[model samples]
Target: MTYELRDHTADVAVEATADTLSALFAAVADGLAAASAESVPDEGDRFEFEVAAEGREALLFDYLDRLIYERDVRLVLPADHRCAVVGPGEGDSGTGPSDPDEWRLTASARGVPLDAVAAREIKAVTYSEMALERRGDEWYAYVVFDV
Candidate 1:
């Protein structure tokens, strides 16, 4: 997986590419976490959270939003992301990922509280220029953060 910072009109954007959906999610999460902090500590508190969406685009949006919410509520700068994607998500019934059914993301992340690191104020994740798609053999994502 690879991620790079991109220039944005007023905020900051990140573009990531990976070989799998899980990797893609993790890469984007990594980008957001890095954008939110100057550096990630070697050790941190680990936590898990879940989010469900109707499609890949919304799933990606919600995933990033959840991380930011976690940061604000817990006062932490999250990193080391791991994600699992499931269609017909937990309690739902559907055909598959393309079924327009619920898709769930169960993510695990690690981070140190704000007091342990220098952090930037990232207010939220925006849909402006946001994207998630499969290109050839890789999955790509582009996201803008509202700073």
Candidate 2:
């Protein structure tokens, strides 16, 4: 897992890279968690969710947005995640993002309760300066958020 927090004026920018799409998404989720909480508590509950989009970049956006939504709804900070890219059908695995409508994701996310962690409160995940692309066999995404 590789990620960095780049300075983005009023907001925060996260750049993540991985050998696979699922790992890339997980890194981005972790970056968000790191930005939101000072330290993510280890003893937290895990939950699963599925998110899909017409394109790889959109999928990343929805994946991060879902984590934020879960945080606000459950009053928890997502500390970690494991994800897999799949075909359109449930439980179907894929080689990773290739087309707009062919890829989807299933993610298991762990969360530390809001009261158990120091929260920074990320407002939303923004598309401004956001991108997801393939660099050789690795995948990379640069996302900006409204903090």
Query: lDDT: which candidate is best?
Result: 1
Tens digit of lDDT per residue, candidate 2, span 1-147? 699888899999999999988899999988998888767778788998888787677888888999999988988888778998764454445445445455688899887889988799899999999988889989899999899
Clashes of each: 0, 1
Estimate the TM-score of every prediction.
0.90, 0.89
How many Å off is the CA of 39 in candidate 2? 1.0
What stretches of model 1 exceed 4 Å from their correct place? 88-100
Question: Which residue runs of candidate 2 sit more than 4 Å off their true CA positions?
Answer: 87-100
TM-score of 2: 0.89
True lDDT of residue 12, candidate 2:
92
lDDT of all the models against the reference?
0.86, 0.84
Q: What's the CA RMSD of model 2 in angstroms?
A: 3.8
